[model samples]
Target: MLTTGNDTVLSKRATKTANTDEFLLTQFEKAEANLFHAKDNPEGIVNMGTAVNRVMEVELIERLTKPDALRFEQRYMHYFNNSGLLELRQAVADTLTRHLAPDNPVSPDNLAIMNGAGSCLDALAYTLCDPGDVVLTPTPVYTRIFTDIEERGQVDVMPIVCKAVPDNAEESFRLYKETVEDKILETQSAGRRVRALILVNPNNPLGDIYPPGLLLDIMKICAKYAIHFISNELYSLSIFDEDANFQSVLSFKDIPDPERTHFIWSMSKDFALAGFRTGVIHTCSSSVMKCLGKIALYQCTPSLIQHASATLLSDKAWCDDFYLKINRQRLRDRYSCCLARFRGAGITVRKAKAGLFIWFDLGPYLRSRTKEDEMDLFQEILKRGVYIVPGTQLYCEEPGWFRASFAVSEVELEEGLKRIQQVVEERKQKGQVSWSTY
Candidate 1:
C-alpha cells in the first residue's frame, strides 16, 4: 500500500489509475446473472456490480462487421500511391465542404489523410513544437493527445481550468471563455509563448459543447498571440439536441489568419466506426499540409478504411441517416438513462449537450473521503465492479471528477446506472457521506 498523505499525489495518473484504464475492459458474468468482470483473465477482479454486464464484449466487437461494412472495406482494392486514394481524399474534402466549410471550402489539395486523430496530432507537434515549447490546453483533454504532445514530442502542457455554470440547463460557454482568457494572460506574462491553443469542441470527459462565440473569442486570443488553433471535432455530429450543434472553427468566416487554424475529423464516434481508424487534417496552408503529408507518407492509415470513408462521404444521406442517426440516438438514450438514474438519486450531473458521456461530479464523495487521493473513489467503484475513466486521464487537475462513457447500448447503460446506484447505496450504508446525484 501506498500512502497519499500529500495533496499533490492526486496530480499524476499513478499506478492505481493507469491500471484502471486497462481493467476497464470487461465481460458479463453468467454466474451472477447481472454483473461485469474481466473477460479473459478470471482472476483479474477489477469491478463487479448489478448495473453493468460484461458477457457481450465479444459480440460488441463483432457488430462492426456488417455486410455493408464488408462491401465498404472491399472497395479499397485499388490502392495506387501512398497519398491514400485520391478519389477518397477528394470525397472527404467534398464532404467536409458540406459539413464544415463556410465560404472558403477546403479544397482536396488542403487535406491530408491521417492514420487517425493521434497521427494528425503527432504530425502537428512534430511540425510545430520544440522540446522546450509549452502547449496550452484546457483540463479534461483528449487523453491520447497528451502522449503525442507531451511524452513523444517532449513539450510542456499548461492546463487551463474550466468551470461549469451551476444550476444552468447545460454547459456554460461564459465560464470556459473566462478560464481560457486567464490562462492565455498568465502564460504570456510568464514570458512563455503558448505555441498552440488546443481545444476539444465537445470536451472529452466533460461532454459539453463549447459555443461558437466562445470558439471565436478563443480565436481572437490565439490570433493576438499568433498561437496555432488545433480543434478536434470528431464528436461534432453526436450532439443530442439539434440546437446544441455548433459550427466548426473551419466554418468561421471572420477568423483572423485562417491559415493558422487546423481541423481534425474522423469516422469513429458518429459512425460507431471506432475501428475504422480514419481521420483527416484540414488547413489552408500548403506548407503545413505538405508537412502533414510527409508524416502520412510514412505511416499511412488503412487503405480500406480510407476508401470506405471516401465512398461513404459521397453518400451524404448515409452520413445524415445511418451514421448520424444511430450515434445520436445512442447518445440521447444513454445520456437520459445515466442522468435520470443519477439525478433521481440526487447526484448533480454535469450539463452536456452532445457527446457520448456525462462528466461526473464525485466532488461530494471525494470531499467526504477527507483523507484520501481521488483514486479512492475510483478504487471503491472498481471494487463494486463498474469501470469508468477517471477525469485525471484527461489531465484534469481536479481529482474528484470522472468520466462515464455513454457509448454502450441502452440495456448496458441502464445496468451501468444501476451498478453506480448500488455503489452509492453501499457507501451510504457504511455511514460515509457518499454521492448519489448525477
Candidate 2:
C-alpha cells in the first residue's frame, strides 16, 4: 500500500518519495487529458464542469481599462514585501468590510494576501493541522478543497455525510449544528484530532448559502472543541438572490472563538479574475497571521497583479454600483435561464439562490445505482458533446447527482442543455430510464 493508503503499485524509486505527490499528479494530469479543452473544442464540446465566470466579459474588460487601472511602480521589482503589498491589503480590507463586515470592520493588519484561495487553504492546513489530524467539511464540496488541503498538508478530510432522503423538498443535505458536533465527536473517538472545520458559504457546486444562525451554531461547536474555523467566503458577493440573506463570518459581532476563526476570499469567483490569482486570508488569530506572513513568501501574488487588483478594489463607486450590481444581475439571469432549460426538459434541480452552478439528479438516466453507472452517464453526456462533473468527483454520498456550471455564454449554455435533452430523450426512448433501482 502507498503512504497515502492508495492501492497503486509502486516501484522502488517511488518508495523514496511520497506517494501522495504521485497520486495528485496523476489525478491532475487525468483531468487535463480527459476534460474538454475550451479553445480546442470551442465548437465541439460544451464545458459545464469548471466553476468559473466565463460570462460577462464586457464588464470585466471595462473594469480593467487604462484610465482607471494602476501602473506598476519601478520599485515593485525589489523584494520589499512578500506578504502582500500594503496598499492592496488595505484595499481588500476596505472592500470586504464595506460589503461583508460592516459592523465589525476588518483591519489590514489581520489580512494576508496570496496567489489564490487554494494556496491560502493549503498554507492554512499546514499551519493548523499536524500530520494525520482530521479536518471536517460537508459534501459534496468544491473538489479542489480535497487536493488543496490534503496533498501538501497531509491532513485527512472526514466528510460530514449529509444524505439525500426521499423527501427532497426539505433540502435533505442541509448542514445542522447537531450533525456537525456528532461528526466531530465521532472523529475524536476514533483517535484522530479534529483540527478545524471548513465551511464554504454561498457553497460551490451546490450554490446554497447558509443562514447566519446556522453559521454561528457551527462556530460555537468549533469553539467548544478549541479547533480552528476556516470559512471560505469566495462566493459571498456572487449571490444573485434578492432574499438569500447571505452573512459573512466577519459580520458576526460576537464570535465564539475569535482567535481560532479565519476567513478566505478571492477575486476568482466574484470578480471573474481566476487567471489573476488574487486571494486574501483574514484572521482574528495573531499567531495565524504571523504564520501566514511567513508562509505567504512562497505563495505571494505578482506585484503588478496586486497593484492592479488594489486599484480595482479601491474604486468604491465602480465596485459597488456598476461592477458588483451588474455581475450579480447577470449571474441571476444566467442561473434562472439555465434552471428553466433543465425544468423544460422535465429535469428537477435543487433550487439555487447563489453561486454559478446547478445541482440536478440524473438518477432516472442512470443504468444502475452505482458509481460505474454514474460514470457511464457522465461519459454518455460527454459523448453528446456536453461536459459536466459527476457527483462522485465532489465526494457526494449519493450517486447520479451532477453539478453543471451555468456561468457560460448563453450560446454555450443552450447548446449544453440541448445536448443533455437529446441524450435524455434518446435514453428514455431506448428504455434506459431506471429510477426503479433508485
Candidate 3:
C-alpha cells in the first residue's frame, strides 16, 4: 500500500535534481561486469574499494575457528522465525544502558531482528508511510534511503540541506536538527504531512560524527513534533575518533514517548559481518512495532543470518570488542589524503568525521556536457581503477559531488587516491566534467 509505483519522490521545490553516473551503481556494476571475464583476477581495488576485507585480516580469526562460523556454524537454526531471541535484543539494551543511558533499560520485547537496516527501513516505512506521505530527510543521505522511501510512491520527500561542518562530525547533529525543523515547517505550510524523520549516525555520505548535544536537539524536535523518529545507527559504533563520538538518540531514556523513536543497527559494520546480513530494530512503542510486524510477515530474514547474528548479539564481551574494533579501524586520516589532493586541484570537499567515506564537491567540474556525455566521463574514471559514489546518485540537486571510502589499508588507500588524482588530471585537461545532466 505504501509503494511509490514508478514515480520517484524527489523534491517539490526543486525542478531539476543532479544525478551522475558517479553516484549511481554504474561504477560498481561496470567493475562487476569486467570481473565476469577476469574471474581469476583476484578481487582488486576496482570495486567498493574501501577494504571490506579489513575484517578478514582481523586478528580475531583464531577466535572464530574455521568451522562453526564459516561452514558448520549452528547459528543458522533460528532463521525466519526468529522474532529475535530475547537475549540478543537484551544485548542491544545492555549496550544502550552501558554506553548511552543507565536509568532506562531496553528489554527484548522492544526489539526485533530483521535482514538489515534496510529491511527495518522498509518495515517502518510500510508501517508509518501511507500513500502520499512525505519523508523528511537531509541531503546526501545513504542512496538506498531514497530508493527505499521512493520505492513506495505513497510518500513525497523533502530534503533539508545540511551545511558543511568542517572538522566536527558530532557537531552536525545540532545542525541536522535545526535544518530538519525548518524543512518540516516549510512542507507543513505547503499542506503536506511530514510523517517521519530519518537519520544516519556518522552519516552515510558525509560521515559526520554527530555530538550528544546535537542528538538531544534531534530527540527534542522529534518528541515535540509527534513524528516518527527513525534512527539508523548501523554505523554508530564505527566512530574512529572518540572525541567525536557521542551518545545516540536511542540513549535518551526521557524520550517523550519511548515508542515514537525507533532504532536500527547491526553487527554488520561493527563486526565486519556485512555478508552475515542480519540486523536489529528496537523501539519501546508496542503499537508501532506491531504495525512493523505485518510488513515483516511478507519478507522474513533468512534463517542462517539470524542464527549467526544471535551468536554475536548474545555475548556482552563480543559487543564491546566489536565496537572497539570498528572505532579503531575507522580512519580519519583518509580525510587528509583526498582533501590534500582534491583541494590542491581546486576541488572542494566536505570533512568526513567517522565511518569510511568522504564526499567531494564536483560542481566546478560539471559545467560542461549532456547527461549521457557525463556518464561517459564517469565510466572513464572506472578505467582508472578507482571507483566512487556520485552525488546525483544520492539524490541531490548539487552537481560535482562523489563519495570515497577509506576502509582499505594504508597502501590500497594511497594507491586509490593516486588513481583518482590521475583521473582528475585527465578530466581537467580534457575539460570533461559535465554539469547539465540534472
Q: Give the candidate number with the greatest TM-score.
A: 2
Name the TM-score of candidate 2. 0.92
Off by over 4 Å in 3: 1-26, 35-45, 49-82, 99-103, 163-178, 314-323, 330-347, 365-377, 409-411, 428-438
Between prediction 1 and prediction 3, which has the larger TM-score? Answer: 1
Model 1 shows how many backbone clashes? 16
TM-scores of the models, in the order given: 0.80, 0.92, 0.79
What's each prediction's clash count? Answer: 16, 0, 21
Give per-residue CA lDDT, model 1, range 1-438, as digits (tens): 345675544435454344443322332242234344335443332332212222223433454355543354444565445546787788877776776674658677777877777777877887777876788888766566666576556677787865444444255223456677788788889988778878887767667777777888888888887888999887776678666767887778788867788888776665555566677788877888777766677657777666566656676676655555655765677677778877888677777777767776665655342225467777777665566766665566545566777665455455566767777677567755644222
Ranking by TM-score: 2, 1, 3
Summarize candidate 3's per-residue lDDT along 35-59 as a digit string, tens digits: 4112455344455433243433453
lDDT of 2: 0.84
Model 2, residue 148: what's the lDDT?
81
Query: What C-alpha RMSD separates each model from the true structure?
Result: 7.2, 3.9, 6.4
* Deviation (Å) of 207 in candidate 3: 0.8
User: Per-residue lDDT for 122 in model 1?
Assistant: 75
Please write out the lDDT profile of model 2 over residues 6-108, one tens digit for every residue: 5456654354345444322443354456544446655476777777797777777867877647576787778857679998999999999999989888899
- Winner on TM-score between 2 and 3 is 2
